[model samples]
Target: MKNSRGSLVRPHPLPGSASRPVVTPLSPSVVYASDTPDALDDQYEGRVFGYTYSREGHPNGDVVAARLDEMEGASGGIVTGSGMSAVSAVLLGLLKQGDHVLGGNQLYGRSLRMMAEDLPRLGIDTSLADPCDVDAMRAAIRPETKMILVEVVSNPTLRVADIAGIAALAKESGALLVIDNTFTTPRAFRPFDHGADIVIHSVTKLLAGHSDVMLGYAVARDPALNDRLRVFGVTAGLTASPFDCWLAERGMLSFDLRFDRSQETAARLADHLAGLDGVKRVLYPMRADHPDHARAVQLLGDQGCNMVSFELTGGRASANAFTKAADGLSFAPTLGDVGTTLSHPASSSHRALTPDRRAALGISEGFFRVSVGLEDPDALLQIMTDAVAAARAAEG
Candidate 1:
């Protein structure tokens, strides 16, 4: 017997618990109770598995991390608030002052900016080089190089890196190779299979399938390095909310189905666009004309990727017209949505780069990146064909 308020605060416990539900219950509690001080100490000290605080350790994050670990074939992993946060945790955790990073120039623009601009401010030097050119990457590696960061498939331009070749380089140089596998999820390319020390993913995209959740994670092949990343991730306050983690896990339930459909559609879309009059060059990893076609084949098999980029004959005006005429198609700044979407590099992902830099990377004003979705291939093809006509009409 207790006062009303007291009774309300501490409700009667259900003798035990119901049978486990199929869907995981979201535990969004910021803090959890401990039976005793020694128990909590043990939890914090990693003597046993348990949650103390959401920011430090939690059930939801652990579940998703474990799932990703199994998917990426790693012993351990940690989920962060976002993809960039995951990258930040890895760089800050692994490297110290005076260490150097040799990063791919064609990585996601934000990632490249972080390595080239932000890392240097922390006394960590970075050199940007073409990851496709293994010889150039080897030459660029310095004695102090502590990390070799690259993407499985570069963003926007769709360049495919030689993961095994570069991994060998990293090993020879005694540098840890960190591969960003956002574009090529574990279903397509598991970096661990090719000697990658660490694999990172923006689970917001393909892993989650839908575009609703914002989550990311880093999986480490070595347990020691994974533990270090977890410590830094917790210290840096990069942990994600339980709700987001739960949603991401739910999204992954249908990952294989969504990935396979979108990838198949993207291959067809690339072919359709290539034959259009207003298109200059279509950038799809599997395309025979693509410079990295051979490497892409060896790495990704027949399924290249769901992302496709192509240049319009009329540049920005043509792109503007195409989007305007292409009714029902979303012009999202982000990628990996269930529905087909378009992104303009000049305005979205690579907008921060100088004009010369954009040109050097072949991200022209006319360049449009398509995040192929679960839409009907024939319907998407028709929409694209009409849009190309509109683009040409505007150019004239």
Candidate 2:
């Protein structure tokens, strides 16, 4: 078979399979049979004869990782049980007791929590800096800092960081630059292009497109790091299920189409929301008034993924009213779904943080993060506008 570019491609088949079939969704197996003692020995030694056990390795996960590697321009990649697992594995695999990590203050709530609480328990120190402030990040770095971790586009707030600048700093500091590329998938931005040493993704989100599967991926620009991550994943039992890997691969097929549609809708909605009466602030990187607009254009170009965050003037009351009035839009805590959804940071993603911390991050009860879907932009805008008006009216 040949791809659209007319390059010859061979079918991916399982090693132990008798049939040379084109369409192969390799069955999930706990253990694979070894024909000979030599083959078993090779499997035990990690000689790559094929998967010996599902926990160590599997065909479905390998296929998905290979594809992610190709997309992200990574040397190697591994699939994990969840996004947090991918983050934890990479940190655990690379850093030791004395190592330090510099992370973005605006990271996902769970990530921040892990950095603040979990890494310290492992005897690793962490410092959180404003991702938008390169100087602050530089100042925060210590001699023991082994990794600089940040999201390509921050969660909830949608703040765009300077990946290239951070990468340069990390290189000079002898630290690895690790980016959570979950927001802008490889379709929109390849972290390697900006000198990221490692790229992480929550395949549960955009790559899966549909909200059905939970998977994570870590793609390494260095082969050694990749090997370390894989070993850590296998040893720690962080492997994703074969069925989820298979489903993720299938979802990746239409990722480009889904991404483009949702991104376009989000851009339009950001503009609409900016002018809406009840909206106090709109934070979309593509918007000219956004603080990181220039950086976003430099890094992501016009491809701003499906996220637009806005605040209501009436605080929590208006937000509650707006969500209640939004007929078709679901108030989902998650993002990257095909259907339009809204997430409340104060009550969901950022809920883990204290009220003071949430205030410090500019996340309030009025703030709402919208994950624009593949729905028609015009119709979605109308529904959103009506919802806002109703919310304001209710406040009056």
Candidate 3:
């Protein structure tokens, strides 16, 4: 319920949110038959009733949201304009003043900012811990803790969180486990299957597939939470547009195929980087030397995602040079697109994070994240390989 003016009001419900919502179309779009001059009065006719406001729910918006919910096998899901909006909607709905949010230190930068500064201003407190250290996470929880936020595969550095272990801890503490499954999309990981209460995504990256539309969603396993979130979404006016949702729906069709090829590219790259002369570290979640490879294999099973992170032999400058020299891959600020994207986390995605915080997270000047695309594997390899070589020569 939204408290505004003088009274609290219930938000309009979307179809498929329940077993069935009596969705009547907006004033009913007319379907004309060759012989009919008047509208049909039959039950099969679409309803004239539709969303009075987009904030309540758009028709296409609900359709794609339902698609995502079904995909996640969630009780329900809500789509938002951007990934950060999805995070904001959930955090704002569930957290209040004096509440605590525990996030993994390796979280997406935007998320860290939202929890650290945005939520705190509303009286909620936030903390972060090394996700690789289950003991650290256990120690971080307090009586006021309401949520544990983590990425399925962490940002900048692709550290894999122990989802099952953390979910258990969240349950014990009576806290909700919210997992950002953007990097590892449903193609790679299903957070709910591992015990997460909520799964979040930046559809602009993977789910949308094309890097064309910016969208996000939060999927809930709990029916009550799903209903409450929908109300909050409608009342607060934080909702996704119909067009973006439509684009996302279109993108979902090719998800499995695109990621399959991208993963193959990522594996080859991770392997190649691990042995390369100028590479100091490769942080692919599936790599054996990664801090969470065992858990990744256990959690991800066979499908490891397309994102790969590595440190340049030199530092930030070298990383920039390499990314600039790359031909096939665009140096965009996002991931999970159909084409490859490279970004310098310290300056781009995680820019909101303080220098000290970024340093602590190991998003160094030398660190670069590569989002493998659908480009030919050999071409991508050559482009990336050449980028590194150029950076090394320039630095030398």
Candidate 4:
């Protein structure tokens, strides 16, 4: 018999059973013990399938990574602590000090800053170009350009890039084509199908469908590239927590249903708000008046995205009024919640950019981005109408 201290310190695991639970069990252990030194060595060398430490990898992360890889049609991938970390792993891991990166100017503000500002300090050069124009991107690429980063549909603005065109450009220049697919998940667009070398996602967004988890993933088409990213991710300590991975997996179970309903509602709201009073412009990829309408349809199909961006006639004051007077929607700095929410790009996402840069991207003080949720379509429309009226009154 063991002493009380020994018993307390090392409790025996429950008996193993053949029956499996319907849901994937969450294994939160930070370290795993191998039966033998040989077994441990095999795990470390990738000679066998297992894990030694959570930072290197955990079971949950692997499961989620595999799921995302399958969804994106990738051979393999890695999940990271956050979306930015995933992007960081790719850029920092692949590029040398003197390498250049050609990126889209209208990516999420943080991503834009990372490429345009942060990478430059590290001896890496970057150039931002129009995402929707292949010729503009081609003109920006240099001989040293090692990576071409872009998004299918830009954030806060509904500009759609010609992925196939940019992919061809990357191939010609011997640069890796990396795409951020957060705005249009695999449900709407699969970057890999269009020749993307790497596809990234902010899993905190629509992938998780809840405002709860902050996770991200990068899927690589090539197994060798995936291996490099995994090494970098492990070394940089960018591995995701087990609980977040579990939550993301659970959220994705109902992703299709939530995505369809919310997408439908977003389409309804964007169309209705286009001609409404106090609205200067509505930017929905599916809208005929949108600049990328044709390309968006060709790439994203008729489904469109759950996000809607619009400009208020009164600028900042009208935006503030609209948020204040809006019913059933709250002003949030983040998005991808089951509940509808609004984001002010000028103050929140793109506040770091200079006024000139922000203006160049068409992000005015009056610009508003909405993440339509699983709400009644008729009720949401009425709420939007009433809010617009209230905003106009406040502006007047």
Per-candidate alpha-carbon RMSD to the true structure: 1.4, 7.2, 9.2, 1.4
Q: lDDT values of the candidates? A: 0.91, 0.89, 0.81, 0.90
TM-score of 2: 0.93
Per-residue lDDT tens digits for candidate 4, residues 151-222, read 898888878998889999999999999999998999999888899999999999999989889899997888
Q: For residues 345-393, could you state the per-residue lDDT of candidate 2 as single tens digits?
A: 9999888889999998889888999988898888999999999998788
Candidate 4: regions farther than 4 A off? 1-8
Summing lDDT over every window of 10 consecutive residues in candidate 4, give the lowest-scoring window. 5-14
TM-scores for every candidate against the unseen true structure:
0.97, 0.93, 0.86, 0.97
The TM-score between candidate 4 and the true structure equals 0.97
lDDT of candidate 2 at residue 83, scale 0 to 100: 90
How many clashes show up per model?
0, 0, 6, 0
In model 2, which range of ten residues has the least summed lDDT? 5-14
The lowest-lDDT stretch of 10 consecutive residues in candidate 1 is: 9-18
Regions more than 4 Å wrong, model 2: 1-22, 46-48
In candidate 3, what are the lDDT values of residues 247-293, reduced to their tens digit? 77778888888889899989998888787777788988777888877
Screening candidate 4 with a backbone cut-off below 3 angstroms (N, C-alpha, C), the clashing residue pairs are none
Cα-lDDT of candidate 3: 0.81
Per lDDT, the best of the predicted structures is 1
